[model samples]
Target: MADSITVRGLSADAGQTPLLRDVSFEVRAGEVVTLFGPSGAGKTTIAMAVAGLTRPGVSLDGTVEAPARTGYLPQQAAGTLNPARRVGHALGELVGLRVPRMTRAQRRARVTEVLRAVAFEGDLGPVLRRYPAEFSGGQRTRLALAQVLATRPDALVLDEPTTGLDAGRKTELAGHLGALARNGVALLVVTHDPDVVAALDTRLLRVHNGVVTPSEAPQPRPTGATRPSVSCSGSPAAELRTVSVHFGSANVLREADLALFPGETVGLAGASGAGKSTVARCLAGLEQPSRGTVLAGGRPLPPLRRRTRAQLARVQYVWQEAAPSFDPRRPVEVQVAATATRLRGVCPGEALAEAREELAELGLTPAQAARYPPGLSGGQLQRAALARALLARPEVLLCDEVTTGLDTNLATHLLGHIDAYQRRTGAAVLLISHDPHVLTGRANRVLTVENGQMVG
Candidate 1:
């Protein structure tokens, strides 16, 4: 069979800076290829080039070809989906050309078929009618996958496809991808999840310093800290009491309770839709609870809008997608300093100094901090987001899958910074992640969430 995709001496760049250099690889029919690299390693850039989305000035050299049909799932599923469209509507649009001559009943049947293939079990009657905002992050991601699969493309390129999915959903999606490969679809996945990498017989490629090279072995996992839990003699830093969140009769999260004491780190794990993120949002005051209460430093959390600046400053959250967290039009220094100015009462000059210092701690140079979000790599933005949160020195930090899309080295590096920062400031940390490796030996305690309830 003809090669499903091929690249020979592929080099790509944005403006004067090279994004990927001297890369060569090929994907055969029914083969799965995995790309691994730190955040700015150009994994996504390569994926974009392969999918024919790279823009002018973002030049590409050498030969790159895919089959006539292709499907691409980007890192940001929510952004990829039209906010005004329902799940059914999105899928219909994707497969519309093929189904243009079909009846309404026939189109509905195809939509249901693809949703089932992607293992989506939500109420389609309502979910198909509602907009993307009505669905949770995980639901939107699944819908995005379903939309891609509906096209029946000959090749699939997924960029950080499993970043926001819960473990169960991750497994389900992996299984579907494996099945698609078995059916002769060329599969290219850009991911950081070990489980995703382990599931496929893959052609592994590693990208670094704007270059790509083949690799035989997977990246090594981090050896996490094995120390005893630190002492918390005073009041706990943050505590959640029977917190619950429900969306339109669907109980996304049950009465979940957790406590984070000073100088402690707690890792939250679960399958997709297990409510780990819901709990994080609730604790960060980004989402309100349907029932139950939350307390920080022994005081009840005031209404989110009514909370004092200091009270709000005590809890900071680093989101999974650091790009959206930033203002694309502003310089990184301005974005990072906004956090410090609002929460730390620091002037621009002092905040910039502190931001630079924090960025240095995360392995970024002062020069990188002067650029905008679009110019930074995946790892740089990840580090910058963490620096923004740390600049305020919040007593409790809520990390919601912050390292989901990062490569092994960068993920480990970022986690190390989080550990060091927690130790230095004696702050409490609630780390929400789907990767068990992240929690295996690092956390003081681990909580497994299943079907919206906390178990052990």
Candidate 2:
């Protein structure tokens, strides 16, 4: 069988700085190729190049071609989809004209079919009508994948597809891709998950420091310091009692209760639409609960806005997609410094200094702060978002799928910083993730959600 994709002498650079150099590879029909690397290794760049998104500044001198139609999934699903369009409309736009055209009913049937293939069992009937904002992080991702698959493209290029999905959904998506490979559709998956690498019949390619090389051996598993225990004394940093969220007649989150004590690291695990993020939003005061109450430092949190500035300062949230959190027009330093000045009452110069220091601690150099968000890599953007959050020195940190697109090394390093910071400051951390490995040795406690309800 002919190869689905072929690349030779692939080199790309940003201005004079190289991003990917002399990279060459091929993905044969009925096969999957896995790309692994640290942050800024140009994994996403390669995907973008294949998808024809590379711009003029990104100098390229290589040939990458696909025999069959190509479908590309960007790293940030939230930004990829049109917020104004419904889920069904997005999928409709991806279906190829060569495919059998169908009526609205037939199209809806096809949408439901692909969603089922991806293990999304929610009431998509309603979801199909709602905008992107109505779906949770994981749900939006599944919808995006379903959109790509609707075209029945000969080649599927997924960039960090498993980032926000829970374990079950991850496995399901893997199965779908595996089946696609069996059907003679070439698969190129860019991911940091070892389990994903092991599950597919893949040729492992590692990208590091602007170099891409084939790996003779599989990547190593991540390791970290021993897990710490949370003491039962003192007031819990945050508490949710029978919290529930209803959105337009649908119960997105059922009555759920959770407690985060000082110095505790709690991991929230669940498949898509399992209500993990809804819980996080409720605690952060971003989403008000339909019933029940949230307490911080043993006192009721005034309705999100009524809460005192100090109360609001105690809890900070870092989202998985940091690009939207940042203003494209603003410099990273200005964005970080502005938050610090507002929350900590620090002068602009002092706040800028603090932001620079925090960025350095998060593995970024001071020079990086002068650049805008669009220039940074996915890993850099995530770290910068965390740095912005840390600038406030909040007592409680609620992280929603923060390490989704990072490579193993970068993910390990970032998680270590979070752990170290928690240990030193005793700030409560609520980590939401789909990777069991991430929760295994790092989280002090693990909570699983299913069907919008906490199972345990």
lDDT of 1 by residue, 38-69 (tens): 67778888888788877444788878899888
Model 2 spans > 4 angstroms off: 1-3, 55-57, 96-101, 122-126, 217-228, 303-308
Best by lDDT: 2
Which pairs clash in the backbone of model 2?
A: none
TM-score, cand. 1 vs. native: 0.91
The 10 consecutive residues of candidate 1 with the worst lDDT sum are: 218-227
> How good is model 2 by TM-score?
0.92
Candidate 1 residue spans exceeding 4 A from truth: 1-3, 55-57, 121-130, 134-136, 166-168, 219-227, 230-233
Instruction: Give each model a TM-score.
Output: 0.91, 0.92
Q: Global lDDT for candidate 2? A: 0.81
lDDT of each: 0.80, 0.81
Colliding residue pairs in candidate 1: 39-378, 39-379, 166-272
lDDT score, candidate 2, position 15: 74
